[model samples]
Target: MKDRLAASYWLHESQYAAMSSSAVTERRRAAMERFESEGFPTVRHEDWKYTSLKKILKAEYALSSPFSEADESETLEFKDIKRFLVNDIDCYRVVFINGRYSSWLSETTHQGFDVCTLGSAWKKYADQVEPHFGRLTEGLGATVQLNTALAWDGLYVNVPAGVTLDKPIQALYFTTGEQPVFTQTRSLIVLGDGAKAEIIERHQSLTEAETWTNAVDEVFMGANAHMHWVKLQHDSPSAALTQHSVIEQKRDSHATVHTISTDGKFLRNNLDFKLVEPGAEARMFGLSLADGQQLVDHHTRVDHLAPHCVSRENYKGIFDGQSNGVFNGQIHVHLDAQKTLAFQENDNLILSEKASIDTKPQLEIFADDVKCSHGCTVGQLDEDALFYLRARGIQRKEAQALLMLAFAHDAVADIQHPSLQAKLHRLIGKKLGVDMG
Candidate 1:
C-alpha cells in the first residue's frame, strides 16, 4: 500500500500537459524526460537527506493553474508589516501572482531600466537569450527540472552598460492560491561594465494556502560592477519553497547575497557562485529561524576557478518547536587558482530536543599554496548567559529574545542597508516572540 501510494503521488506531481512558449521547448522537454527518469528525489538524495517529501507529494494535492486573478494587495501587503519601506526603491518593479506575471500590478520602467516578462525577453533577445538562459542551472536537480518544465513567465531585468540607477530593483513573488501549486520563476539580471545597482527579491504567501514554489535566478555581475541582492522568503505554514541563486562574477566585481528565511512548511535553498576572473569577491550571509513543524535547509557552493579570488560565507539558524534545519556548505578550489582565500562557518542553535539541526561544512582544495578553512557548530542557548542577562535586570522572555538577537547579530550586521537591517531585527524579534526596547 505504501509503495502504491508513493507511486501515485509521484505521478500526480509529474503531470505536465501544457506549454506557453517554444523558446526553450527542446530543453524543457529534455528536463521533463529527466524528471521521469530520476523520479522523485527522496531522502536518499545526498542534498535532501534531512528533508521528507512524503507530505508534499501525497497524491491528493492539486496543481495550481495559471492565475487569472491574483490580488497583490490582499496577499503580500501585511497590516503588521512596514509596507511603506518597499515603496522607495527606485528600480522597476515586477510582481508575480501565483506563478504568473501580473501586468496590472507591475508597470514597465519608462527609461534607464528594462523590465519585461521572461517570455517576452525570450522572443526579443532570442539570440542572446539562448546562451545565458537556462544554461547555468541546467543539471541541478529534480525540483529545478520541474521548474524548467512548469514555468510560464518570470522577470527579466536588463540594465544598459554603464548605467547606474539610484534605486534598487524589486521583484515580489506571491505564492498563495487555492491548491498546492508548483511553480518556477526565472530571473536574468545583467549588469554592464562599471554598472552599479541593488536588487531585492521578496517571496511570500498571502493565505495559509498549501503550495510549493520552485524558483531560480541568474545574476551576471559585469566587470567592475557592484550589486547587493536580498532574498526574503517567509511564507505561511502550508508552503514549500526551493530556490536556486546562481551568480557569475567577472573581473573586479563585488556581489553580496543576504538571505533571510522565516516561515514555510519546508524550505531548501541553493546559492552557487562562480568567480570567473581575478579580483572577484563574493560574500554570502544567510539566516533561518524555524518554528513549529517546519523544516528549513540551505546548501551552498562557492567555486574559485580563477586565481586571486576571495569568498566568505556565514550561515546561522535558530529552531524551536519540532522544526528541523540543515546546512551544507562546500568551498571548491581548483588547480591554478592560487592565492585563493576562502572562509566558511555555519552556526546553529536548537531551542528544543524535538527541534534539531544537521550542519556539514565541506571543502575541496585541489590547488597548492592557498588558504581555505570550513567549520560548523551546533548547540543550544547558554544557561550562564541567560543568568547573566537576568542578573542585569532583564526578564526571562526578554533574555531569550536578547540572546537570540545576539546570536543572529553577525548575520544581521552584514546587511548593506541600515533600513533593511532594522527591518530584519524587528522581524526577528517578532518571530522569536520577544518584545524589547
Candidate 2:
C-alpha cells in the first residue's frame, strides 16, 4: 500500500516541477522519500494508539488535479456556498473547491500584505517563502510528509513587522465532486516582529461522497508577534480529515489556537508548538462533539526551550451514541527553561453508555525553577445540574442541551472575537439541536 501510494505522486511530478520553485521541488522530493520509508502509522505507534487508520487506508481515493478552465464551469449555488461562510464578517476570504483555489469565490490582497495561494507565493514571493516553507516539518511523521510531497495549492499569508491586519482572514476548503477523492493541502503563515493578525480555517464537504483531506500548516511568529487562529471542522459524516499544525514562536511572541470539531466521520488533529526564545506564551483550546460511531482525536505538544515561558491548554469532548474521542497533551520544559509556567487540562463527557473517551495529559519538567501541572477527567453529564435546569421548567432535551452548552462555555468564552464566538455558539447550538438564544 505504501509503495502504491508513494508511486502515485510520480504522475504529478512533471506538473509539480513546472509550478514549484527549485527549493520547493527539492523539499518535495525529500519529503516523498521520507514518507516512502516511514509509510503509514498504525495503532502500535504510541502517538496513534487510540486511533486507527485501517478504513482510511483501505479505501481507494483519486488524487485531485490542478484547477483548470473546465473546473471554472463547475459552479455551486450561492445559497449552498453561503452556508459555509461566516455571516456578517468584514474579513478577507480565500475559498478552495476540490482542493483548488476558486478565484470567483475569493477576496485576496497583495498591496500591503499577502493573502494568496501557496503556488503564487512560491513563484512570486520566493525570497520571502523559501526560508520557512518546509523548515518546520523537518522531523514530522509520514502523513505530513505525504502532504508536503503532493499538496498543490493552499492559503498563504504574511504579516510584516509591526503591522496589524485591518480584518481577519478566512480560508475555506470545500470538497465537491462525483467520486471519492483525497486532497492534500499545505498552508504557511508568517508574522513578523510585533505583528498582529487573526486567521480562520474551515473544511466543509458539499457532497455526501467519501472524501479525505490531508493537510499541514506551518506558522512562524517573530519576536513580540501576536496571532489568533481558529479552526472549524464540521463536514459530513462521509468526510475524513487529518491535519497537523506546526507553530514556532520567538522571544515574547504570543499565539492562541482554538479547534472546534462538531462533525465528521474521522478527525485527527496534531498541534505542536515550540517556544524558541524566552518570554514566549502559547495557548491552546479544543472542543469536540462526536456522535454515531464517529471518532475525534487531538494530539498536542508544547516545548519550552527558553526561560520564563508559559503555556496553557484546555480541551473538552462530548461523545454520543457509539462515538469515540481522544486527547493527548504533552508539555515539556527543558533544563534551560527556568521559571516556566505551564498547565494542561482535558475533560470529557459521555452522553451514552456506548460513548467513550481516552484522555492523557503529561508534563515533563526538567527545570527546577519551573512550575508545571497536568490533569484529565472523563465522565458523564452532571445529573445535578441537569435536574436543576429541569426544575426551572425547561424541557428535558433543552435542559440537556443547556447543560452541555454550559459545560463547553469555559472554552468557548476564551475566543476573543465576538463575531466568531457568536458564530461558534450558533454552530454548537445547531449541533445540539437547541436554540442558544
Candidate 3:
C-alpha cells in the first residue's frame, strides 16, 4: 500500500504540475516525504494502541484524484440525494461525488462572504487560501500528512469580520464507483473577528462497493468569533473513514463540534483544539453506536496555552453484537495558563456480553491554580429500570431501545438546530431498530 501510494503521488505530481503554486507544491512534497518516512501508525504507536489497520492495509485500493473527469456523477438527482440530507432546512449546499464537485447538486455563493469549493477558492482567492490552507495541520500525524499530499478539493467557507451568516452551510460527499477507492479530502474554514457561522458535514457511500476516505479539516476562529460544526457519519458497511479536525481559537473565540456516528465498517476520529489566546473556549460532544462487528475509535486533545481558557468534552457509546469501541481524551494545561477550567468524561454501555470497549480519560496540569478533572465509566443498562419498563407492558427489545435513547440524549442536547436534532433522532432510532417518534 505504501509503495502504491508513493507511485500515485509521483503520477499526480507529474500530471498536474501546474495545479498549485510553488510554495504549495513544496509543502505537498514535504508532506509526502514525511508520510513515506513515518508510514501509517502501528499498534506500537501509543495513540493507536487500541485500533488496528490490518483490514485496510491488506486490501488493494485505487487512489482517487480530484482532477479525474471520468466519473458518472451527473446522473444523481435530488430524490436520490434527499435521504442523506437534513430535511426542512434552508442552507447553502455543496455536494461532491467520488471526490469530484457536482454543480447540479450544489448551491454555492459569494454574495457577501465566500461559501464555495476549495478548488475554486484556490483559483480565485489564492492570497487568502495560501495563508490558511495547511496552517493548522502541520506535523499532526502520518495520516494527516498523507491527506495533505493527496488532497485536491473540499469545502471552503470564509466569513468576513463582524458579519454573521443568516443560515447554516451543508457540505455532503458521496462515494460511488465500480471498484474499491481511497480518496483524500481537504477543507479550510476561516471566521474573522466577531463573525459567526454554523456548518454541517456528511460523507455517504451510494453503493456497496468498498470505499475508504481520509478527510482533514482546518478551522481558524478569530477574536470574538463563534463556530458550530457538526459531522454525521452513517456510511455503508463496506465504507471506512479516518477523519482529523484541527481547530485554533483566538482571544475570546468559542468553538463547538459534535460528532455522531451510527454506521460504518471502521471509523476513527481525531479532534484537536488549541486555545491560543486568553478567554477562548472549546466544547466537544460525540455519540457512537456500533453493531455487527463494527469498530469506532475517538481520540481528542485540548491544549490550554493561554490564561482563562475553558474546555469541556463529553462522549458516549453503545456497543452490541461483538462490536468494539475505543475512546482516548486528553486535556493539557500549560504552565502559564492559569485560571483554566477543564472537564472530560467518557461513558459506555455494553449490550451483549461479547461486546467490549476500552476508554481512557487523561489530564495533565502544569498550572497550579487550574481546576481540571477527568473520568470514565463502563457499565450495562440498569436492570431495575429495565424490569420496571418491562413490567409496564413493553417488549424487552422496545424497552431496551427506549433506555438506549435516554442514555444517548445528553450527548446531543447541546445542538441548537431543531431540524438537525430531529434527523439525528430518526437516525438513532433506525440504528437501534425501534421507532423514536
Candidate 4:
C-alpha cells in the first residue's frame, strides 16, 4: 500500500464507495493519494484561516457510514416548500438519511428525466461520471475530498435535451443521531440543450443531532439550457456543515444558484463557475443569519475562459449573539476573453458589537477588453435607516429587524421560487425576532 492509502485504513473504503455507482472508487484512490501528500488542512491554510477543525478532531465523533437509524420516524420532507411538486405531484424526489439514500421515501417518475441512485448510475456511466464526479470536491480542499471519498448514498439527476421538468426536483438530507457524526453527500446534475428546470436542495435534522455534513454538488449546463438551484440549510447548534458547488456553463446557457444558511454551529460554502464558451451567463446569490456562536463562510470564484460571457454575484448576512461570518469572492478574467462582464459584491450587517465579519472581494483580470469589478462592505445596522423607519412609529427591535430585512430583500427577492422565497423569508423573519410560522 502507498503512503497516502495508508491513512485510508482508518476509513471503510468499499462501504463508502457503495453509495454511488459513479467512479467513486477511482476518485477515492486519487483523493487518498492527494491526502497522502497533504494530510489535513490547518488554520495556516489561507482559505481556512478562521475555521478550525482541531476542535472537531478532538470531539470523538464517529465517521458515519451505512449505519441504519431505527429511531427515525421514516418521514421525509420534500414538499417542505409550498409550491414544490416534489411533495404532491409527479416531481422526482431523492431522500438521504445520515449520508445514505432511503429508496422508500424517494421516487423517479418524471418523464424524459433519468433519476437513479448514485451507485446505480456509477455502474453504467462509470467512464463519464468518474472524471467529473470528484473534480469539484478535489479542487475544493480537504473536507470536501474526504466527503467524496466517504460518500455512501447520493443521487444523480439528468435532464435530457429540450425537456423542462414540471416541478422543481427535490433532494432532502436529514439526520437522526445525538453524538457528533459526519456525512458527505455528492450529487451530479446535467441539463441538456434548451432544458429548463428548478432544483431545491433542502437540509434539516430530525433530532437536532451534533452532525457534520460535507456536501458537494456539480451542475453542467449544455448549450442554451437554463438551471435554477435553491439550497436551504438549517439545523441544530451542534451541527456543522461545509457545502461546495461547481458549475460549468456551455455556450449561450444560464446557471443560477441561491443558497440560504440560517442555522448551524459552523458552516462554510464554496461556489464556482467556469464559463467555457461564449454567451454563457452565471449568477450566484446567498443570505445567511448567524447567532449563538455560529460561524458561516462563503467563498466564490468565477473563471471567464471565453469571450462574450457574463457573471454576477451577491451575498448578504446578519450576525448576532456573538456569531461570526466571512465572505470571499475571486473573479478571474483571462486574456483573449474580450467583452467579458463580471461583477461581485458582498454586504454584511452586524447586529452586535460582539459579532464580526471578514470580507474580501477580489478581481484578477488578464484581459484588456473586459469589464470586471468587485467590492465588499462590513458595517453595523444602518442607524439612519433604523431611525428613519422608527421615525414612522416602528418599534426599536422591530425597526432594526425591518432595516436588516430590507437590506437582505435584494437577494431574497431575486429568488424565482415563491414557495422557497416564502420559506426563506420566514427564516429571516425568525432571525429578526419575528414569528416565522
Candidate 5:
C-alpha cells in the first residue's frame, strides 16, 4: 500500500509543484507527510474499533488519473446515467466521472455566486481558497490527510452575503471502470453572513467492479447564515466508501445535515460540528439500511463552544441478513458555554437473527448552566404492530416493510428538499422489496 501511494505521489509531483509556492502547496505537503507517517487506520484505533479495513487494505486498487474525452465517451452514456439522477427538479448539477470533472454534463454558475470545481478555484481564485482551504482539517485523522494529498477534483460553492440560491446544487460522483480502483475527492463550501443555500451530494458506481472512494468536505457558515446539506450513499455492493465532513458555524447561524446510507459493501462516516459563536444551532440526522453482508458505521461529534447554543442528533438503523451496523454520537459543552442545550438519541432494529448492531450515545458537560442528555436503544420490531398490520389483510413481508418505513419516518422527514425526499422514499421501498404506494 505504501509503495503504491509513494508511486502515486511521484506520478502527480509535477501537478502539485505547479501550484506555485503558496500556503495550499505547503498544506498539501504537510498532509502527505502526515499520511505517510500515520498510514491507514486500523482496529487498534479506538474510533475504528467497530470497523475494520483488512479487506480493503489487502485488495490492490489502481489510483485514478485524469480521464480523456475519448475515455469518457467509451465509459458511459447520458441515457444510462440519467437513472442515477433525481428528475423533475431544477438544480445546478456538477458531475464527475472516474474522479474527473465532466463539464459537458454539468450546469455551473458564477454570475452572482460561485458554483465550480475546487481545481478551478485553486488555479483562478487562490486568494479565496488559501485562507480556509486547510484551516478546519489541521489535526484531523489520517484518511482526511490522504484525501488532501491525492484529491483530483471536487465541488466548490461560495454564497455571498444575504444571497439565497434559487435551487439546490447537486454534486454527483460516478465510478465506471473494468478494474478495481480508488478515488479521493475533496470539497469546500463557504457561506457569507445571512446567506442561504441547499446542497445534495451523492456517490454511485456505474459498474460492479470493486471501487473505493475516500471523500472529505469542509464547510464554514458566517453569522446569521442557514445551510442545508444532504448526503446519499447508494453505491454498488462491490464498492466501499469512507467520508469525513467538518462544519463550523458562526454566531446566529443554523445548519442541518442528513446522511442516508442504503447500499454498499463497507461504509464509514465521520461527521464533526463546531459551534464557534453565540446563538448557533445545529441538527444532525442519519439513517442506515444494511442488508446482505454489508457494514455501515457512523461516528459524529457536536461541540458547543458558545452560550445560548442548541444541538440535536438522532440516528436510526435497520439491519437484515448478516449485516452489521454501528453508531457513536458525542456532544461536548465547553466550560464557558452557559445556557447550552443538547440532546442525542440512537435507535436500531435488527430484522434477522444473524444481524447485529452497536450503539453508544455520550454527552459531556463542563458548564454548570448547561442541559445535555443522550440515550440509545437496540431491539427488534414491535410484535403487536406487526400482528395488527398482518390482521388488516396485508402480507407479512409488506407489513414488515411498512413498519420499517414508519420507523424511519422521522429521520427522512428532516430532509428539506421535497424531490430528494420523495426519491429516497422510493429507494427505501425498493430496497425493502415493497411498493411504497
Candidate 6:
C-alpha cells in the first residue's frame, strides 16, 4: 500500500512540478518524504494507542490528482445535492465533488475580502498564501504530512481588518466514485485585526464505494478577531474521516468551535489551539453519538504560551450496540504563563451492555499562579430522570431519548445562528429516535 501511494506521488510530481513555484514544490516534496518515512501510525504510537488503522491501511485505495484537466466523470447538479445542505440558511457556498472544485454550485466572492479555493489563492495571492500555508502543520502527524503532499484545492477565506462577513460560509465536500479511493483536503483561513467570520463545514459520501478522507485546516486570528466554526459529520457507513485543525490566536482574539458527530464507520478528530498572546480565549464543544460497531475518537490540546489566556473544553458522548468511543484532552501551561485559566471535561453515557468508552482529561501546569482543572465521567442514563418522565405517561423509549437530548444540549448551546441550531436539533433528534421540538 505504501509503495503504491509513493508511486502515485512521484507520478504527480513529475507532471506538475514545473508548473508550480519552486518554494511550493519544495514543501510538497519535503512533506512527501516525511510521509514516506513515517507512513501511517499504528496502535503502538502514543497518540494513537487506542485507535488502529489496520483496516484502512490494508485496503487498496486509488489516489486522484489533477494536471489541468477535470477528473469528474459523474454528472451532478445543484438539485441533486440540495438535500445535503442546511435548509433555510442564507450563506455563501463552496462545494467540491470528488476532490475537485464545482464552480457552478459555489457562490464565492472577492469584493471586499477573498473567499475562494486555495488553488486560486496560490495562483493569484501567492504573497498571502506562502506565509501561512503549510506553516502550522509542517512537522505534525503522518496523516497531516500526507495531506500536505497531495492536497491542492479546498476552501480559502481571507477577511481584511475591521470588516465582518455578511453571512456564514458553507464548505461542502461530496465523494462519489465506483472504486475505493482516498482524497485530501487542505484549507487556510486568515482573519485580519478586528475581523470576524463564521464558517460551516461538512463531508459526505454520495455512494457506498468505501471512501477515506484526510483533511487539514490552518486558522490564523489577528488581534481582537473573532471566529466561529461548526463541523457536522454524518457520512455513509462505508466512509472514514480523519481531520486535523490548528488555530493560532493573537492578543485578545477569541475562537469558538463546535463539532457534532452522529454517524460514520470510523471518525477521528485532532484539534489544537495555541494561545500565543495574552488575553486570548479558546472555547471548544463536541457531541458524539456512536452505535452499531462504529468507532469515534476525539483528541484535543491547548497550549497556554502567554499569560492571562483562558481555555475551556466540554465534550459529551452516547454509545450503543457494541460501539466504542474515546476522548483525550490536554491543557498545558508554561512557566511564564502566569494567571492562566483552563478547564476541561468529558462525560459519556453508554446504553448497551457491550458498548464502552475510554476518556482521559489531563492538565499539566508549570506556572505558579494558575487555575486549571480536568475531569471525566463514564456511566449510563440517569434512571431517576427516566422514571420521572415515564411516570408522566411518556413512552419508555421517548423518555430515554428526552433524557439523552438534555445531556447533550450543553455542547451546542452557544451556537449563535437559529437556523443552524434548528438543523442540528433535527439531526440530533433523528439520531436519538425522537422529535426534539
Evaluate all candidate structures by whole-model CA lDDT and list the values in order.
Answer: 0.76, 0.87, 0.88, 0.76, 0.86, 0.87
Per-residue lDDT tens digits for candidate 5, residues 1-437, read 86677567767767775753367777887888898889888999888888898877776777786432335432566786788777667889988877888787889999789998887788687767788887888899888988887765789999999999888899998887777778888898999999998988888887778888888999999999999998888889998989999999999999999999999899999899999899999999898999999999999998899999999898989999999998989788999899998989899999999999988876788999988888888888899999999999999999999999998888889887687899899888888777977
How high a TM-score does candidate 4 get? Answer: 0.90
Model 1 clashing residue pairs (backbone):
none
* lDDT by residue for model 4 (1-437), tens: 12322344345566555644535677776776566666667889998887776644555555556544443443455443233233333456777777667777777654577675565567675655776677655666766666666555576877889998887778877765666666677788788898897877876655555776778878888899999887876766777777888888999999888888888788888898989999999999988889888888898989999999999998998898888898888889998789999988888888788999988887889999988877778888878888898899988888888878888887789787676678678778887876655
Worst 10 residues of 3 by lDDT: 66-75
Task: Give each prediction's root-mean-square deviation over alpha carbons.
Answer: 4.1, 1.7, 1.4, 3.5, 1.7, 1.4
Model 6, 247-319: lDDT tens digits are 9999999999999999888889999999999999999999999999888899999999999999999999999
TM-score of 6: 0.97
Q: Which residue runs does candidate 5 get wrong by more than 4 Å?
A: 66-75
The superposed Cα distance between candidate 1 and the true structure at residue 177, in angstroms, equals: 3.0
Instruction: Report how far off residue 290 is in candidate 4 (Å).
Output: 1.1
Off by over 4 Å in 4: 1-24, 67-91, 435-437
lDDT of 1 by residue, 1-437 (tens): 22332343345433322232354666666676676677668999888898777667763444444433444333544343235226634546678767777676666563876767775676676655566766777887877776665555677877777888667777877766565555567788777777877878877666565776778887888898888888877777887878888988999888898888887788889999999898899999989999899988899999899999999999999999999998999899999789999999899898888999989988899999899988888888899999999999999888988899899888879776787788888888889877745
What TM-score, computed on C-alpha atoms, does each candidate reach? 0.89, 0.96, 0.97, 0.90, 0.96, 0.97
Off by over 4 Å in 2: 67-74
| Predicted model with the maximum lDDT | 3
TM-score of decoy 1: 0.89
Q: What are the per-residue Cα lDDT tens digits for candidate 2 across 1-437?
A: 57766776776677777776888888988999999888899999899998998877776676676733435324766576897887677889988877888888989998788888886787788887789888988789999999888867898999899999998999988888767778888899999999998888998887778888899999999999999999998888899999999999999999999999999999999999999999999999999989998999999999999999999999989999999998989898899999999999998989999999998887788989988888888887788888998899999999898888878887789888888899899889888878977
lDDT of 3: 0.88
Superposed by TM-score, candidate 5 places the C-alpha of residue 150 at a distance from the truth, in angstroms, of 1.4
